[model samples]
Target chain A: MSLPLIKRERIFAAVLIIPCILFITVFAFYPIGYSFYLSLHRIILSLPEIGQPFVGLENYRALLHDKVAMHSLINTFLFVFISTFFELLFGLVIALVINRQFKGRGFVRAAVLIPWAIPTVVSSQMWRFIFNDKYGLFNFILFGTDVSSYKAWLAEPVFAFLAIIITDVWKTSCFAALLILAGLQTIPDELYEAARIDGASAWQQFRKITLPLLKPALLVALLFRTMDAFRVFDLVFVMTQGGPADSTNVLQFYGYKKIFTEGLMGYGSTISVLVFLISFAVAMLYIRFIGTKLFKETA
Target chain B: MNRLAFYIVTTLVIFFSLLPFLWFVDTSLKTEIEVTAIPPVLLPSGTLHFYRSSIENYNLLHYVKNSIIVAGSVTVITISISIFTGYAVARLRLKYKGLIMGALLMVSMFPQISIAGPVWRILQSLGWLNSYQGLILPYVTLTLPLGVWIMASFFKELPSELEDSAKIDGCSHTQTLFKIMVPLAAPGVFTAAILVFIYAWNEFFFALLIMTQQEFQTLPVGIALFQGQYTLPWGEIAAASTVATIPLVLLVLLFQRRIVRGLSAGAIKG
Candidate 1:
């Protein structure tokens, strides 16, 4: 059916997409390639006298031994795992709640988007103020004695980590909720009605009907949020500056700090490459597992 | 039992979602002294001084104007490009459609942090640093892929008979797209514009990295800088934050239904 215009169509199609191809090549592929090139050479901005020198794989070796890099990798994974998990869990619950026919549902839905719509930097700063040691609302709420002292949330490692997590969960869970709500709406109510006719409990109906039906949407939401959470930088950077002792330094911030603060451009590029690889691997895994399964099932 | 449990849970969820904003508003209305009182006044002592002072001193209007210009220009450029590109990809029966679509999706998912260094260098070389053009150009890249993908899906879902009839009347391809198909796809285009505008408005990292001058900063960056400079000024910070968020909140409220439907449709396909 497609054979008659194969040659002409191919040429036309190639022409149509030339600009996009060029864009991706220069903006996407070039940067990725150049990052690797930059990583091969040591360039320290502070010492102009030292200039640029080819260091082979020494940058990678140094990264392997670098405590800060190792810490950040672990912290990054921890953040991705923890935040994505909670966001999905709470988002699902919220979606299920709002998906039901109820009074004021429209208002609830609109109100829910308030947190998600606020810019990350603005929300991060707001939460930072809320978590302030002395005059902040957090301390005011937990108003208590010495051991439970009013510690500057961003000035303490554990507290800063918790503060970042809380702020992130608050800000982004709405996004997760919104996505999952979309998924929930796709499950026909007739499925639940039929399940109820069979004497299934609400929980059972949800488990069998809603869960199975929501799998694809859930996976899409998970993949999006996971990728986003893994690359989180602005919120943590604004709120804590990866604080007290670099406890909250995720991979992005770690890389930014290296390049900008320390002027270790080559080292930063190496970290950036690792972050790219990790996220790329995760994306591939998601496509292989969830994407394939969802398509196969839908088909 | 289920009804009662649902009501209780719903109330708790609403409270959780609203408490932050409520606290923000409450703080914004209070004087600095009232804000930092020992037990922290939840409600103001009938004062609007903080908000009044914040508006007068912070140059909130300037930041608002900067955000509008950057975000507005980004939306216009993104929508313009995606309109043609999306229509061609969707209707032209173009070969390599799958590859093109996949590349678009991949670009949307690619992390910006990785490209920040090179983007910074490119913008510097072009002498676009600290300029609206620098911000808008990269923002176009940020918004273009998603806009194209979503608008393409929208265009694909639209019936082609209208375009066919217009073409039979001897309209050029560009005219068919612009005059006929575009009117039909206005809703999707508007949805795409809203998403792009919001994304551009809310973006912080690139804005901070590229536009270093105080005057060039957008709302998000401006607010962050405000917090840094006035670390102890919680009431004022809250006032500024509240001011920064009001426009988007109002927009979301006004377009709540369309936004939700658009999000669902866009996500389902893309």
Candidate 2:
């Protein structure tokens, strides 16, 4: 009777998970498999004349030589690498500042979420307005002239890229701070107090106690931000549309243009595969970190 | 002086985070003249010019309704699925526990663009293009993993002894879940619901991709496509965006702790 009861519970658990697994499979897993399948064929939705053909690695080979894809790939990596580094640095300062007890701390924490809470489309558009050459806020702040002497921030490659980076840092640094702040909170206060009792300076305390304990959280924040940043699209789409000769085009946006705009399904799938590979590489890095740490801790 | 430095840093953080939206809000209130005027209007022009016109001339409210319907359905469906699956994972003695979590995490990392072609094809096959269900299905899939992660963490935190007591008191497993566990995990549910709702509301890519019909277009999609041939009515857009974001900002302010806790748990644990 006891064995049956346990078996019944196990059956219930299996039944409960079926719906969740089914939805995920239909919408998530199936699409990934189908996308890969699509990537191998020369399927152009726009050109029925071409017909679908088995292309195998041709799309992948083309992607290697394609200038736009290569540029976008490089741009995606550069953007993620640079922006993530700065975001981490800025977020660390922010987390440290807010981690202390202070008046209006709650307000500060709440207000800090405003940028992150605003939708990516909205924030990107807002930044676009702010970076508008003629009558924008950035121009007003930097120029303050009645004459037309402001730089077209979104029209030039470097400036446009910089504009995107600034908007991204603004939108995401709060997310970084929130994650880091959560990590900081997990560091027991007594450790800092103990270090203080030993006459450790504030810097010394942070270096010895906070940094070591905060490693996991810091890694999580870095991992999350870097992955999302590499797949940057909406911001680029709404703001620059990967403009100024595709200088600002990241891989995701490049793929969107191919699939949606150009209607090159197979080529687009290749770009998507490229994006997937980059993201997979990042995930692999995170996994290796986790694998080593797990081994060490359990050992 | 140390406290002074702290306050200064605090104020800077708040100011930087809040100023972009504040600048847009200021633009929203100004007349078209002030909005375009050089040496740009630093303050509100005390006119509800764009707000009034955008609501009257443009169907701003229509997009809001579409967003509400789509996002609301998504939250209901996703939270329902997530709670059940989360409960299963948290309580059941299941093999392949690591595999399930790993699969979900790996699935989450698949670039949305990577799935764009297949998802579009599937929607086309189902004849769900430009429909509410078209957007909600994919939205649920994208948001479900985080939901499950949050709820499962919360469920794992509760003492199993409570479940045992409920069992002895003549509660069926389902009844125990509803009467005892759901109430305790209500915070997790609420957190997950708020997050899923926000995600569904603010998602632009899939919304833009799937909802082509004006009537079906959500807020982000509608506002994004709200430009004229030669001119963009920045004032009108700013007004609409502010109106849309106000409720979200308020929700975040009111339940900042829950949002933070839910997000950190999903992310840090992953």
Candidate 3:
């Protein structure tokens, strides 16, 4: 009770931090460990009589040869790569447009954020309705009075996949733009003035100055978008439900189907574990590229 | 680009961003006949018929109430816990501060599915499934990283001399935090609360898996699973969607600056 003030303060700090650590350890870290352990066992929810039995690496081996799992993995990658590409492209354009001082810039920025602020479920449903065959905005604009030419866009494999990507890009491009805008704000006007004095055109100045300076923000946006795209479940669950012949199925949805719908608990854990490892690996790579100095700055 | 071209492109970007949601809003106001026209109607008659039906028949209020309870509880609890943690890391002389912050960054990056299975089992063992506490506990844990990071940044910005003078004046660590630092960090607390509330309200994956009962489901889950005997109820779904999104839209319009600052803080600082 009579300890030095420094020791007392340190003890108090430890007490303050313990609760936060406890919540994460119990809920987040524990669950990840449990998921890994479950992946090594064989448990079927419906058939409890079989009991849980550890079969080391068997589920992992099975996942290696599982055709549907393989297909969904491919779909997940395709979704991540394509959607983030468009997200970055569109995000850059929006950031550049709204970056400048203009009339009603706040209004325009708020308008741009509306799609992002709306829940993924609501936006997914909106897109679903928009691509409706008989009476949808997409068809109404395309076919107009030519009712015979209207098609059920979501029923086709290619279009359904495309629709989900389009929905994601629309919703998240604003988020990417916001990050890029933060980066744009950091660039000095003096650099542009110097470039102009040296006779650099607008495009030349952009290429030489803006693009190079924007790399870190662009990478951060890409990292966030990539991770989110891999975890896409609400869109698939709401729109297509893994769909016209499982074409729209992604990794998380497939895992949900395996565990929740099909009751293959152990197998589903394997899929989820794979997801965690992939995300962890990608995050590591991005962190390295962005450098640990970023964390140091925040810390 | 020319002035005219700049204006055109700016207008086009905003229009493209808002069109889908506006179209849904338009559909929500349409008469039943206008909703399903072969060539869809360009304009609505401005009816509230679907909203009435959605409230009465769809039990939209129940889902809204559930969402409010869960999201509100998460925001309050997360912000409270994070205040202490943030002060400890940002103000007090704590060893391993860098490690704790790095660990939190990793937790924030974790995929939900990675933890979904085991967390479900843990809840079931405690027999808390399909309850508000069941959902709120996980949400608090998930949102804590965001809350802590934002709060820490805000706390770090405050002058250390203020806290030191309070300590020299015989104030306890707790008093100095609650009386001095907490008020200064209120904006960060507010930002974190809004973000956490939006996350809990919009979350569908956990809500769908955990809250299977109709009475316990949130708005996103309820709307996602909206059904009818013969066909999908597009009008009612649109009505429910419009209602669910209005608060968030209003939030964006009002606190757009805070929202942007909160979102970009973690990314750009790094």
Candidate 4:
């Protein structure tokens, strides 16, 4: 008896999904496929050349030996791993602190988001100035002796990388905290109450009950941050332009430079395709491990 | 003992979170002399010169207007398109539903920088370079995937019975979407709007690559240019940054819960 209605509703659902299908096909899937196509051929803009030669995976071969591409790939992974780790750690602490009953918790929670809300470019610029060697506040505060002798923060390799990481961590930790805090709020107070009744200490209860329950949210937060950190561009570009010696160059910036600055469109496309692959791999892993459970639960 | 330790840690964390901003405000209020004073002045000596001078010299208001215009338009367009498209995906049992959803999610993962070169060339040929449409359209495209995903989750949470009941009342699909689904999904809509607004407002690469003219520049680009031009004008830069940041700060503060919920909603669900 219900078969006919179920079938009809299924048909209706199909009808409803058509627009998104069309939109994604045209804008999303097409561009990705086109990018791969572009990567296989040599493209020259100056001489008005499009697909001059079918290079047949030669671009990928060249990218393997490309020093800048290799360096950027390593840096991208480093940035993602290090920043994501710290963001999760700091975010966990902040979430735990704010989740407790305390005076002005609301204000502190709100205040924390200020860094997250400020445009990355704006914050990068703000931090860039603070890192300035001459009359820069960071040098003034840290050294307390000579403001003029401060290192060019964006010039040196190590400092520049550290500076970008600091900016990223600052901007994104609040976001991680917000997500973890939401996860914390979902656990019933009775769980904690029950744990307390069994003589469980705060740390013990947190370790046993809270951590396990928060696994889904924690994984989701990690996945989001990992993907985002890998594709980092705006702050790095604005802060350093992959300078004072290409120290802060990540894969995305490297790809942009290849296409726009070098005009090697094919090579640039290859780099982008690699970035897409890396991110796609991460996304797939996340879905397989964490997203599957989330979807199953919701469905 | 526990309360004291908690307070101490909380205070330090808050201070660490806020020190950059405090330094920014402090720098903005100091004079050139004070800014470069041999021994730095942590506290301003009640000098309003730098702030006043920055306002008079730089068209901070104009940049603010341009940012508001770009961010506002992008948010409106992205949200509108996502509502219809997201509803379709979430509610409609369309063919290849999994494939469509997967494709959209994959697109969101693609780095914008990867396409910047080709996109730049395309926009140039179309004469969209230096135009608001040029910036807004790509920005919308960039934000749409996440927007759709978030909105879809919102729509999915909604029971289909309500839409069915509305349809049984002689309302067409479009009518049910507008009359029943949209109203029910208002919170999600607001959440999507806030996230899109933040992304568009903070977007730097497209603005930097496409909009070359200063007058047409968004706030981020304008600040970048300001940084490059005034190498030593930390005070002015800080003032401008503070000006640029105040609105977003206020928005986050005012809608703290909504923003948090929105972020968590997207992450936990999508």
Candidate 5:
């Protein structure tokens, strides 16, 4: 390519790229910066006549003392940790199954992806009904027409939380499986063949070879699933509404209620900032372990 | 693994994955009385009553129309912008390609709450709240990262010689992109479009905040905000959910391979 043509190409490329950058900056980057600025002031939408006032770190301080906020933070952390653990475990198992050559493999893969394909709000409603006291499949399965023996699952604090977690695990495990399955595809068949030739049992082969090779993909899945699990609003919003004594109140849902519902814009922005920072920290930690191989490949 | 064990595990995985949603589908088909039967009846009477009621009473078609408009617009816009972005990063000699790619990955990681309040305000100021464009703009922004990554990966795999030859034959970059590279990259474009559509169709948070008006809500938001008179409308909710999900179910069945490829393509590259 000639020098002037190369210049033309670069200009054309810039033209192609600028729109995306502008869109993202305006909608995503600017909003984040604006959110931070909003967090530093006291702006109550309901009490507009009071006027906006600089609160410095007043909202952050208030967040520390807010019992409901603290409780929600704890609940969010628990949901992230527990739901991620089960999703990965189930994901690994599903990945292993689908990776095998079997009859109806395509059907099985499609079937496994159905939950993931459905909207979260829809799934939440489905689970909510399942946990219903009177007309629930859960009660029918456990108590089996023993009408008086049925229990209200969502009415209790602990079970409501558990219900949300179960709903999440059901919906997302297949996504984790797909990522892990990609990792599985990259592993050489020779390694497994050699292990079997050396008289290694299936369990031994998985522990020694499969687990080691699957680490990078597992880390990728972990990073994404954890970030998503932290933002657990739709499930809590639909399934329980952070209810049964606020047992399912997650940080995202709590922040949502604070800002949109109660019009506590300043304090809600603070909560949003906290969620962002925590998710960022987790992503950074995972990226360190996964290494800059990701950056290198994309570049 | 033993054959019996393999079959058992497979059955259980499929059962667990499909049961909850299938239960909802079953519920959608039941008679209003059968829906609430204690020790809930496994076999539905297979009536379309709830579907009729949801559409008639809840204005389900209004929500569906809004979802199609929003998700369709987002996909078209995102895919168009991403094609340019992806091509630039993949084939062009950009000075800061790595930096741009990294920024996109960062954007993908951002929590929706972090941007929700300001985005709402931005739309409000522009007089776009409760409007289609308000929701579509953010949806496009959010889905762009995935679109760019998928398209870029696709573009990278194509032979540079093709573009080089086209250039040698006196073709400009724009002509080559449209006539040659795009048709060749049709699969990637299609994959990105599918994923983006699914995302926009399913997004709840921003839609909930931005489209608070009953007329503007998408299917997900509308189904979520469903209200009942005396008791919670389980039957109608189930019906609306089934109606909302059938297209996605059909999508999954038709394009399972492409959807799987797009998802993993976005992840493994990172």
Candidate 6:
């Protein structure tokens, strides 16, 4: 190949990758940069004629004192951490069950994915009905003995929080199972056979062999689920709309309400920027700290 | 695990996972009276009235049509762009593979909330709001990372010698990709298509924000905001939900293995 051919090859490579980079830059990175710009100005859409004036850090300052904003951030963190834990637990259980040789295992695996595959908005609606005061299934299952015993699952603060958590675990735990199952399949059968030959109990074998090897999958699952759970907008938007005194007001939903309903564009953008920062920080932490080490060990 | 124990756990897992959907399906089949019954009608009533009304009266097909258009465009565009980019990153000795991959991953994790405000404004200013291009542009971008990861994994696994032979034959990079690589990467394309289709079909955030007009609403937004004030319209909602889920269920059943492979491909490798 001539020098011209080499130059053409490099150009071809650059051309190949440009569309992907360009689309993301415009639609992804540009919006982010624009949001940051809007965040620094008081640009309320409802009062647009007032003009967007530069108000450095005022939105962030207000966030510090706004109890609702504080509450939403705390709620978001709790939702992410708690749901991730349950998702990991349930995912492991299903992974273990599916890993073993069983009749109709494939069917079960596909069935479990149905929940995860269903649109979150639709699934959240289903759960809303399931948690409804009058005709809810969970109400019947729990307090069916007496009609008076039915507690409005989505009405009260504590039960509403539990409802959101339960809905999340139901929806996402299968994703955890899928990732963990992939990990489980990669484990050499000989390790389990050797452990069995060594008279290791089931629990012992799991602890000594499966757990360590499953760490990479578990970490990946955690990374995906935690980020996803933190941005729980559709679920809350459908099921509760961050209502009943804003008990379930997650950061994303709160930002959404401000931007859309109240038309506080700049303040809402500020909230969104914070969400971006928090999730970005988490991604960096995963890549720099856990992602590197895990990939190295797995490699 | 023992046989009995396995059976028990599997049953529980299935029950826990599927009960919500089953309940939704049941409600979709019921009368309006049965839907709001105090104790709830546990058994599915054998009727298609709600389905009929949902489609005919509520114009559910219009939304479904909108969904197909937006999601189809998004999938085609995302797949086309990702194929070349994935090839470059995985095969063409891109000098900044780590940086490119990392940036794509970060884009994947980019918070939709963070961009919601500016995205809306941009679309509005472009006069693209309530238009198909508006939704497709962002959906394609937001979903690019996933498609790239899916394609790149498949590209990485293909033997390098094949590319060398193509190069030896004086085939240009695009020619090689079109004539040689695409045929081999059909399975990856199929997998990426399925995953991206599911996402674009179900995405509510941008769908709600961008496609404000009723004619352009997707299935998720249409069903979510289906009923107006004073009435819940649970049956119509359920019917719409069930109809929306059918294609996904069929896809899962037919391509169960591919779905799993596509989902956990790169993540599991780590």
Q: Would you list the C-alpha lDDT of every candidate in the order shown? A: 0.79, 0.85, 0.90, 0.80, 0.92, 0.88
lDDT of 6 by residue, B8-50 (tens): 8888988988888988999999987888888887887779989
Candidate 2 - CAPRI tier? medium
Residue pairs in collision within model 5: none
TM-score-better candidate, 5 vs 6: 5
C-alpha lDDT of residue B26 in model 2: 91
Candidate 4 residues B78-126, lDDT tens each?
Answer: 8988887788777775555566656666667767765666567667888
Those runs of model 5 whose alpha carbons end farther than 4 Å from true positions after fitting are A1-3
Residue range A1-299, candidate 6, lDDT tens digits: 46677677777888899999899888889899999999999988889898999999998898889899999999999999999999999899888877877677679879988998999989999999888888888889987847788877788987788788999999999989999999999999999999999999999999999999898888888889988887898889898888779899999999988998899999889899999999999977776645575333212
Candidate 4 ranges with C-alpha deviation above 4 Å: A1-23, A49-51, A146-149, A294-299, B45-59, B157-164, B227-232
Off by over 4 Å in 1: A1-22, A144-149, A292-299, B46-48, B55-57, B227-231
List candidate 6 stretches off by more than 4 Å.
A1-5, A293-299
- DockQ for every model comes to 0.43, 0.58, 0.76, 0.47, 0.78, 0.65
Q: How good is the docking of model 3, as DockQ?
A: 0.76
lDDT comparison, 1 vs 3, better candidate? 3
lDDT of 2 at B76: 97
iRMS per model in Å:
3.5, 3.1, 1.3, 2.8, 1.3, 2.4
Clashing residue pairs, backbone N/CA/C < 3 A, model 1: none
TM-score of each: 0.92, 0.96, 0.98, 0.91, 0.98, 0.96
Worst 10 residues of 4 chain B by lDDT: B225-234
Ranked by DockQ, the better of candidates 4 and 5 is 5
Off by over 4 Å in 3: none
Error of 1 at B49 (Å): 3.5
- Scoring only the A-chain of each prediction against the true A-chain gives TM-scores of 0.90, 0.94, 0.98, 0.92, 0.97, 0.94
Model 2 TM-score is 0.96
Tens digit of lDDT per residue, candidate 2, span B57-163?
67899989999999999999999988888888888766566666766777777778978888998998999989999999999988888888888888988999999
